[model samples]
Target: MIGFGLRLTLRGGREAAVRLVVTAAAVALGVGLILVTLAGINGVDAQNARYAWLNSGVTDATSPTAEPSPDPLWGMLGADIHDGARITRVDVAATGPRSPVPPGIPRLPGPGQYYASPALGALLDSVPAAELGARYPGRRVGTIGAAALPSPDSMIIIVGRTAEELARTPGAAKITSIATRSPGDCTGCRFGLNADVLGLILAVTSAALLFPMLIFIGTATRLSAARREQRFAAMRLVGATPRQVSVVSAVESTVAAAAGTVAGFGLFLLLRIPLADVPFTGEPFAPGDLSLTPVDVLLVAVGVPLAAAVAARIALRRVRISPLGVSRRITPRPPRAYRLIPLVLGVGELAYFVGRRPDTTNGQILAYISGILLMMAGLLIAGPWLTMAGSRIMARRARRPVTLIAARRLADDPRAGFRAVSGLVLALFVTSTAVGVMTTMIAERGVPDAGPAARGTLMVDLSRGEAERGAPEASGAPVPDRVLAGLRSAPGVRGVTVIHTNPLGTMVPVGRWHMEAGLVACEQFAGMPGFGRCAPGAVAASVPPHFGAFDTSASSAWSRTVWPAAAISAERLRDLPAQGVLVRTDGSRQAIERTRTALAAAFPDPRWPPTTVAEAGADAENARILAGFQQLAGVVTVVSLCIAGCSLAVSVVAGLNDRKRAFSLLRLAGVELGTLRRVVVLESTVPLLIAAVVAAGSGFLAARLFLEAQLQYALRPPGAGYYVMVGAGLAVSLGVIASTLPLLRRVTGPETARNE
Candidate 1:
């Protein structure tokens, strides 16, 4: 029976051949997309594994120890900023002869030497010593291996320091061995998105892509349904049992599906290198990182064909029950109104969670994901009912032959019409939600706006005590006069204001508030505008304390407080060491770089690099992460829409083929080609527009609720990009449908009608 099925499928002439080819192509695309998604997920896991050791801070001892006998290594981890990019700094010192080595390096470097990642080594070679290299203050021994780096672009430096030097650094811990396990729920972990969040995002993305591909494959298999029904019914009349007929249908679908699956895997291999270049997490994946396991390959290879066969078998139920019924074109039962329940339930669930407002991060994410999944499933289920309702309205309001013909056809089989555009509906919903949340986040968390006057100013922390809490008290020495002289002589120097903090913890009365005092030289303070002017004849002035530029809480605390510039004598100022320095410059990039270079030269410690007000206000790292996600969302949306477009075109062609006899009768009765084209347009457009509006609205609502519930953010409109994404998707889909219009004349021609 299977051999007979193969013979029938292969020898069924051009139409059957076309159907087989289309089915195979659709399955191949589906398979390829799935494989690509799997690769991405695997790549993220691999990266997390490589980066695990970096976050494994001090497993041997929780705190710095004065009397450590057994531990071989003492390590301290910190971060440095260079031209808005973060560099991970690991300061390690060997306390014993047999120290455990970290991944990618041969051994811990001896004193005054360091190992840099390949990217960091290249960066060090490209730039001047003062700007970045002086910060490391060591000889570059070699490059860190790929096994130790998260990505090729990662910037990491493992500096070798003395045991005494590491003991004086804050956050240093005695390490006996390197940890191989992942850092679970470590808030201070260096990697972007923890494992939980990354897994969640990949799962959502896979679901969004996979569902559309499945729909496309199903649509592909059911092409030319009326013709297939006739062929199967004829076999029923020729003494073929219904079981035998189903086997033939399944066999035919499986062959194309199996061939396509293999082709798709080949396509994935071809695209693997290009896929690795997509920086979905601010860093591109290593090509080898994006590989599927043997089990993954086996499942996709086997499952796709099985799914296709099952779909084909289910599609032939009407033929299997009463083949004559299919030949006579009996209408199926209309979809019930209860299909709307899931949509309502899903929306209600989201609303409930939003109003209740979960306290924990995990709880909030779970609720949000559950609501989203339910809504997606609901959209798929309720689509046919909505299509039927719209078609009924169109039928009643029809004032033209195109509208009447389109409406009547859609009313008879709304499910098929809705299914054609269903992929697009889900795509728009997911895209809109993602884009909306991301845009809102970007807007709310935007860089702090210091006035234009603050642009030229660079703030440098001169207090060694500020670097690490556990550092020796002797480290808090006054800045040398030579360093001050160097800054004053640096190119683009306007003036330098030496800032001093109250070491005694004294709270001087400013207005009604007794605020902690920060002292600045009154003469230099007057030259800097926007930061209040000092009183006349005052030698020293009191100002808000200068923490790092990125310290928003401190800035906000003093924003409304009016600080009185209480005069202090120069003799008293001379008693205090300069805690920080404010260097006013020419505001040009060259000037800023030169000033930064001088500061870097002065201070070998990179922990507190010179930063401008703007640099402090802008959260570059978070922005880059969000941008990666935005790119990912955009890619998924485009792919889903393309798949939807293909499904629509195939469904349109199938519709025409199924109703060739009817359309031919209409053509012979003087129906014009333009009217027929308009009919096709109306049918695809009405259901699509309806589904899109519903999907987009639902998506926006979900996004808004999520933001309010999770982040306590106010309602904000999505950016212009959201509109552009949606508009482009609709235009592409309509264009695909229009492209299939020419096939209308071919399918319903007198020659085709006469033969059937």
Candidate 2:
């Protein structure tokens, strides 16, 4: 019986051969996409593992006393910003001969030596020594290995320093051994998203891509369903049992699915190298990081074919039960309005949560995710009813035979019509929600543009280790005369204001109000904007805390009372040591760079690098994170749209094949080819446009609700890219459906009218 089924599937002529080919191609694409997504998830884990050792440090259990252990190493990690790129600096000093070595380097370097990653080496070679290399002040030893670097583009430097140097540095730690896990209090060692968040993101990404693939494969397997049903019915009428017919259908579908699965694996291998170059997380992946495990390979190899066989078996249920009914072309019952209940309930669930301020407890998070999943499932369930309603409206307003014919066809089998556009609906929904949330976040958290005065002002915290530790005064040894002289004499130096913090609880007079504020040289304060000007003959001024980089919010009571106030000339404070300095430049990029270089050369410590007023307040890390999310969203949108296009094309071709006989009869009876083509266009266009609008609306609403609940962010419209993405997606789907129109004339030719 199995051999008989195989023979029938193999020798079923041109139409059967076309079906086989279409099914295979569709399955290949679907399988390939799934494999790629899995590879990316695996790669992220691998990259994280490689970085864990660097983040690990000894806890209180390992280092109980302040006294240095004989065999332990003292390590200090800091960052240096050059051209807006962060270069990670790891300073280490061996306490004994037995100190353990880190992963990438050959050995612990002595004082005045350092090892640079390949990328950092290239960058150091490209730029001048004053700008970056001056801060390192060490002889280059060897290159760090790939095992220690997160990506090929990562910039890292391991510098050797004395034990006294590390002890003087803030946030330094003792490490007995290098390990994959860090202690609980080791905050600086952690990088990127936590494990749970990363898992959630990967799961969401998989779902976003997986559903469309499933739809495409299902549509492929059901191609030419009418003809296949008729053939199966004829077999049932003869000696063939229901079980035999089911085996034949499954075998036929499995053959194509198995072939496609193998081809998809080959396609994945071909694309892996290029895919590694995609900067999904600000850094491109390593090719080996994306390699699939044996279990992953086995799953894709067997799972896709089994799923195809099951879908094929289910599609033939009618033939197995009531073959005579299928031959008579009996229509199934129309979908009821109840299909919309799930959609309403899902929206209500989200609305209920959105109305309140919910904490990020596990229950609340689960509820939010549940609401989103329900809405997604509801969209699929409610699609047929919505398509049916739209078709009915078109039928009522029909002025041409094409409109009436298309509407009737859609109304008769709305599920089949809706299936073609369902994947598209989901894709638009997911992409719209992602775009809405990310756009709002980028706008709110992005760095604000500095005004002209602020742009030229560089704030250097001269406080030794106090500023890094966030001490109350942020005060330390005063700026030496030589350091101040070098800064003033630096190129593009316009002015320098020496800052001195007033002792805690001391109030200084500024206008009628007396407040505790930092004291700055009155002569220099007059030149800086936003800070109030000093009174005439005043030698010093009492400026607000964080004076130079003060918040510019007009509504703030602090800003209202602080700026444009009185000043006092106190000679005693003028001669006091300076805890910080405000260096003003000529408001040019070159001037800023030159001034920064001079400061770097003077202050060799990387922890307290010169910072612009803008950098002090700006959330640069958050901006980078948002950019990564935007890149990921783009990849998801593109992949989903492509799969949706394929699903639309496959469905159109299959519909044409299934109705070729009917179309042929219409042509012979005087229906023009142009009119038939218009009917196809209207049928695809109405459902597509209607579903797209619903999906987009639902997506935006969900995003807004999520933001309100999670972050309490006010409602704001998504950026222009959202609209452009929707427009482009719709245009591409219509174009794909139209591409199948040329096949219409061929399928409905005069010869097609003849009985088989």
Candidate 3:
């Protein structure tokens, strides 16, 4: 029976070929996107491990025990690289350069001479290499290899000299104790599910993408199902059994899917090249990072065709392949209102959580998780019901023949209409949720602070306190007052402000507070609401004081406890006891460079180096982490969207032939072409419009509830432009149905109308 099925499909020739190609193309695209996602994950994880090892200041052959004894390698082995105060991760490898470098970067700094990578070299380009010796402590000769890196766009700097000459110089960034000696070649050694939060993020993201893949496959499999049903019904009239017909349908879908999956793999490989160049997870991918893993390959090879077969079987179960059944218009029972139970449950969960004080109790966590699950499940469960309801209402209100025809078809099998958009609804819902949560988190917590440094002010924290917090591999310690005094006397002799801890490690007092709180010094009233008073010596608090709970008992809690306060500034930080110092330098870049040099030169030894901050990338961990999630969401959304788009296109084309007879009869009965076009357009546009509206509203509500539950009451919704973009994308997707309108002309021609 299956062999017979295959022959019948193949014998259908050009018509069969076209259907198979469309189905295959849809499958190929879905599978390809999934593969690309896998590559991204692998690349990010690989880069993380590489950077981790780089920051540990260790490499394969570096002897760990060899210390300051004369034979020492004085160059930096692996060091925590930074851009301004914020760490850019990007490693600095102190190894012999095998690849040639640009003429701009000098030879491995001979003890004091420094050469920069192309990226680093660009930053130092403004300063003359000869003049750099005084402030930078190294004469930059040239830049590192312009093309050596796997991610040519990476900011890797490799600078070192021959063993004998390098040994002469000492104490630069000597590779200290090795943290990891194992080379990162073994895939088995990599972190897996044990990554916890990271793992959950990837798994959930992958699952999100997988849904659209399935939707695409399912939609493509059912394409032309109406025509297939009719053909099989004719077969049934010739004494073919139901079982044989089922086997034929399965065989047909499976062949197309298997071919598509293979093509998809090739497409993925082609795409990986461009995707690798894209900066994601804070870095561009290494050469092989975007390639599929063995497991991913195996899964694609086996799973895609199998899924196709299963989907085909499922599509068949909806309609009987018999002459009598096919001749009769059979309407399946409309999905009931009860189908909305999951959505209702999800909303209830959200309400429960949103009403309570945000806390991390076990119950609260459970509620959050339950809410997420229920929301997703609810969309799936409610989709068909919503489709049916809309169809019924549209049919009821239909006064024209074209509208009536579209409505009746939809009302008959709303499941088919829902199938086209289920993936899109889920994608939008999840993406909006993530964006909303991030906005809330960012708004509530504010940005990670590195004390106060006004723009155009050169801030140098000689204490190394800020660097130590973010950069684990930093060896620099606190600098003494004498060095700071030297920095103040440097050529850029603009007044320098410094903060010092008393011998007791406590922040020095600026002055007594003059506000109602009687707080002494600006430190005591940090970020206090409604307080704009500057402290003595112009010093202020680095972090705002946490005002206690809002109590309604006192003064009826009518008046606000505090009002918005002026932010701490460099002026306010002038005379405070500080662990760090902020400098007000002239606008000249040379002056800034001179100040940085003076700060570094102030440190007689590398042990207690003074660090200078120009501009931090606002690239703190929270922001970076959130950005990663956003990037993932963006990737998944785009892929899901493409798959959804294809699914709809295939869906419309598949059903066009099925509606030919109805359209022909309607045309015969005096329906206008414009009215028929309107019907074709409405059939798809209305359901999609419903999906977009529902998804946007539901996703927003769910995200809002989550934000409230998390204690982030200051809700910052994603940009209003998100809706505009979504609407535009939806409009484009819905336009695909327009292509089917041309087919209407042929199907409803006088010849076809008379034949039907």
lDDT (C-alpha) at residue 245 in model 1:
88
Over 1-756, each residue of candidate 1 has an lDDT whose tens digit, in order, gives 999989878898887888888889888887888788778778888887787778655342222343333756888777776666778888899888777678999988988899999989998999877667877776999889999998888899999999998887666877776755554444556553466677678778877877777777777777888888888998899889998988899888988898889899999999999988887877888889889999889989998788777766776667888768776767778999999898888888888876688788688777888888888899999999999999999999999878998999899999988988888888888877887787788677755555544556778766554544654333455667887788888888787777776654556554356667678777767656545566666677777555344434234343344445555676667557667777878787667767877776766555666777667656767767777787888787778778878888888788778877888878988999888889889999999999999999988888887888777786578767678878988998888888888888887888776887
**lDDT of model 2 at position 713:** 79
Q: After superposition, how far is residue 250 of candidate 3 from its true place, in Å?
A: 2.4
Stretches of candidate 3 above 4 Å error?
Answer: 1-3, 11-13, 55-177, 181-196, 319-324, 346-374, 392-409, 441-453, 462-495, 500-579, 586-594, 603-621, 708-714, 754-756
Q: Cα lDDT of all candidates, in order?
A: 0.78, 0.76, 0.58
The better-scoring model by TM-score among 2 and 3 is 2
Instruction: Please report how far candidate 1 places residue 157 from its true position, in Å.
Output: 1.3
User: All candidates' TM-scores?
Assistant: 0.90, 0.90, 0.73
Residue-by-residue lDDT tens digits, candidate 3, 214-310:
7777776666667777788888888888777777887888888888898888898778787776655544666687767799889877887787677
lDDT of 2 by residue, 489-518 (tens): 877878877778665445654435666767
Error (Å) of candidate 3 at residue 313 is: 2.6
By lDDT, who's the top model here?
A: 1
Lowest summed lDDT over 10 consecutive residues: which window, candidate 2?
551-560
Clashes of each: 0, 0, 17
The C-alpha stretches of model 1 lying farther than 4 A from their native spots are 60-71, 185-193, 355-365, 446-456, 462-478, 502-517, 526-544, 547-564, 567-574, 587-590, 601-604
RMSD of 3: 8.7
